[model samples]
Target: MSMRVLKSTGAAFVMQNMRTCVNKPIYKETFDVNSLKKICDMLVVSAQQRKLVRLAICPQVTQHQIWTGALMEILNQLEIEMCVKDCMKGSNMAQQIVVNCLRFLDDVVSYDPDSTSWMRVAPKKDADSSPSAKWSDLLEMFNDLINCLKNDHEFLFYVIKLEIMKEGLSQIKDVLVDKNIGYKEALHQQSLVHKKLTKSLGHSSRCLFTLLLYYLYGSIQDIELDICWYSEDVSGNKLYLCVGKIIASDEDKMLMHIFKQLDRALGVIKFVHEMAEMKEILEIQGHLWCIGSKNRSFAYRGHNFFIHGISLE
Candidate 1:
């Protein structure tokens, strides 16, 4: 462990006897965002205090590394620090709130957390560590997917935008609401931001979604999908929020197909959502459905979409 660690990372507060929720049934929670923000805030404050201390009793030039590490720790605090300015759920916030959320997402994504050291969740031991399974292969695949998440946001988003364009305006409204970016202006802002970012960066860029999917499961399967805002009542009441259909089958072929494309489609969905919520031109998140017939009945298939405790699309 590095001796030059920042005090009050806010980890203690986050772990202060909080209810231990693993994978949520509906949504996934990765790093504690609120805790992250508070840590960043303190790191910033500590820097100011340090500056005053430095002025009075400046350390030796050899001690520069210590101060540098301190600053670096603050810079690295972004792993958890997200802009808590926006509501995590609900469609009530105005365009400003949407923009605020987008900005937070943008900064969070754009800021390279790997640039400096950050807290990492411990890895789980594979059950197949015995002589039978290729344990090294599993580690390689896992590492590859992590890289994909780190680098593959833009390529994934492009397909999502295409899908959203096909989904129509009312559908677009549903998308906004799902991501907590609702109302006329916020949706428009996301579109506008995406346009600006994509314009300078070129329209066709590649991301790591497919590659990562291939790395992890050898393909994307066990995906959950839905169709939203396609139905309207006679008087035009918003009845169906989103229709979910998990593509599953007893036959390996059908299940495999869904699994293979799932990562790619989810990559697309995440791309769309990230781009939409980014303050600048970052991608938000988006998901797709492949349930054509829904004939297969597997006990495990229904809950496939929400694996990591985070929402899929």
Candidate 2:
């Protein structure tokens, strides 16, 4: 099928499916702590849970159909699973982990908050001559890749993905251990970030950080790459971006860029702090881990950003 045709049909099919399953239960009626624990146990020891999540969040599926149900279901299961075995086993913490999982899907989906991004898909009207759009070809290539992965039982990506997940769960433990109010406050403020990404209430920065942590844990095959952070805070009503890495030929350039971004971020933090009255905010400082590399001085110059009241954690 042509790429445009596939796009059109795939979209239509997805819309139809969304309408159909919009009401279908994505999860079991009641949250079973045991079943959730089972999933988590399997997840900790096996990589299949990560694979299911990665496939479920694939752009092709998420863009077409609303998989909130599937997500909720899996999340509910995981929460149940983790609570029994781990000290973090409570309705509150369980829900937090599950909600964090949803944010992963948020990044992969075609999200137009204002519904004005349709032009990204529509072919340009100024086509003078028939230029065969590469989109169709790309889609075909992706489809072929998916088929090959399925046929050959390729599972390397999810292997990395699972490693990241373990990191996320570990963060939960870390959050519990940290006793500073600033750390707790930042964690509380992160709830807003969670809401922005998932549009779900009562969940925030902890989830975004969890996602960041998981991605950071997951490694790129054979490449010493940097981290990418997309985090937010709604209570503080601020957004944070750590898009990819700064490509620099020398430390001086990298330090300069990092300082520049931090200076701008500090400005943003100050503005947010002044604009609100006793508002909650998330303070995040992101620095790429360059361990096991040359000249890994473990310094990125500036490494802090604030939303409400900035504090080093």
Candidate 3:
């Protein structure tokens, strides 16, 4: 063959070969906001149905893993949406994503206490066998979503605060009033608290609701006490008085100002009693009562401590 003809023929062959072996650009999977919302909605429905089945008939099914996987996928997509800073910002889909994430976590916590440790919730067996699931990635995803909670997502914040307050009220309801003691009245009071807390999304209103939460759940670690701890140890009646007093005091008004002041006053009284107990402890060690001395220093110190702690609170 002629050199020119051979070169042209070779070039044509090479071009054909290149065309045959052309590499298509690999596209990464991307989901838009609507797609994400739809995914989360379907997953939520599936999880709910699974929970019902697990609760009703078959308790041994491997359901949490399925639920967790769905949650992980949703969160990963949401994180990407958050990073992209596009049309998803402050959208209803974003809010729904957060709310659904929290609801999933709450469901997990409620169903599988073992899953509370996010780092290890994914089955370890999958690590040695399957290459698909990584619990560590799930943990990272969870942490990312959790950190997002502190952002200026007003709806997200409101939902989280409302959930916390509702959980606190649920805890306190039993402690405050049970079947034997005005259960109907207790339900009514809880309904009122719920109504009040859900009324306004204002910061001050949120603060007031959160204050009620703190009174119910906040620890008096300085005094080494809390409502739950006290309720568990002492009679329910006294603790009931402390919690129910606010609802009882202003059943008609249900004013935040009145409840807040009452809550603080009760806290002070509680600390004062706690101080007296500490003074007794000192007395037991012969610090308060000496052989030939009548120094009321312990009482004075207890009173001062009570006053200082209340002021600090």
Best candidate, lDDT-wise?
2
Candidate 2 residue 45 Cα shift, in angstroms, is 38
lDDT of 1 by residue, 65-157 (tens): 232222223223322222332232321222233234334334322424543233333234477643222212322322332333233343233
Better of 1 and 2 by lDDT: 2
Better of 1 and 2 by TM-score: 1
TM-scores for every candidate against the unseen true structure:
0.19, 0.18, 0.23
Write candidate 3's Cα lDDT for 1-313 as tens digits.
Answer: 4534433443333334334221221111111111112212212224444333223211111122332333343345445545565454455544455555555454332433333333432334444663432223324333444454546563363334433333323322322212112335434443443343333222123223233223333421111111110111123223211111101122224334333433443443333234223212111000111122222322222222111001101
**TM accuracy, model 3:** 0.23
Preferred candidate (lDDT higher): 2 or 3: 2
Model 2 stretches with alpha carbons more than 4 Å out: 1-244, 288-313
| Each model's backbone clash number | 24, 14, 0
lDDT of each candidate versus the true structure: 0.27, 0.31, 0.30
Query: lDDT tens digits, residues 1-313, model 2?
Result: 4534433443333334334322222221112111112222211213444333333322222221222223333345444544554543243543453454544444323345533333333334465845422112322322333333332223334223333333233322222111122333433434422333333211122222223222322211122112223344545354343311223223556556544544433333332233222123434343322112242333243445211111112
Better TM-score candidate (1, 3)? 3
Task: Give residue 107's lDDT in candidate 1 (0 to 100).
Answer: 34
The 10 consecutive residues of candidate 2 with the worst lDDT sum are 27-36
